[model samples]
Target: MTMANASNPFRGIRIGSASGAGLAGWQAETGRSPAVVHKHPVTYRCPLGHETTPVFADLAEEEIPEYWDCPRCGRAGSRRPGTQPGAVGPELYKSHLDYAKERRSPAEAEQVLAWALGQLRRSRGEEPAG
Candidate 1:
């Protein structure tokens, strides 16, 4: 049935009226909404040029993180360079070889590779490649 045709049981009821007094008592006591808390916006930029600004609580600057995950590109982002104190430049990527070189000399690496290759060749019953 259409609402216009349906008869409301309390059609004439008003706020604070005897019929709606219970509803009125429980209704929001104030017409205005609660006050909004303070917020701080921080922008982060990824290497791919994606930028995202997220809101944080208006608190100490140190409380904010230095890096955040980019919502658009799924990469780690840092604050814009030279914008804030203690900002750091993007770290240079290091490969496994780079780290291994740091720990061992070229001669040692060659020796290890030769030993490993020898073991593999022996397991396969084949001569080791020079």
Candidate 2:
């Protein structure tokens, strides 16, 4: 007697189960899904030797964290707490101020003063006179 042919096990198998099928079904039913995004907080240690500071989430790219100082190991970088997206810490304005103070030049001081005046004028919506 002749034996019957066996059927293919995966002949009509679909590519996705319930979870994976949602994307396609939802897209077909609706237009699209909302995009997901995240804002991550960062922490930075002082470049000098002092303390570690937590950077604020709303800070701009150029604003450094408060209380940031690393006198011993001298590491300067932001560390993310979890597996979130991260960005480079802000520039240390205090370090720049200290450097400018140590220079102690009249012309440099005058330049800084002028820059500050210009910034003040701009903030107040006034045109800075040249």
- TM-score against native, each model: 0.44, 0.23
Question: Which parts of model 2 are misplaced by more than 4 Å?
Answer: 1-101
Superposed model 1: Cα runs more than 4 Å off: 1-43, 48-58, 67-76, 81-93
lDDT digits (tens) for residues 47-120 of candidate 2: 34244554354656666343343445544433432222234543434566677788878887998899999999
Question: What lDDT would each prediction earn against the true structure?
Answer: 0.69, 0.53
lDDT for position 122 in model 1:
97
Clashes of 2: 9
Q: Write the per-residue lDDT of candidate 1 for residues 44-124, one digit (tens) a residue.
A: 987678889999989798899887766776556778653422326434446678789999999999999999999999999
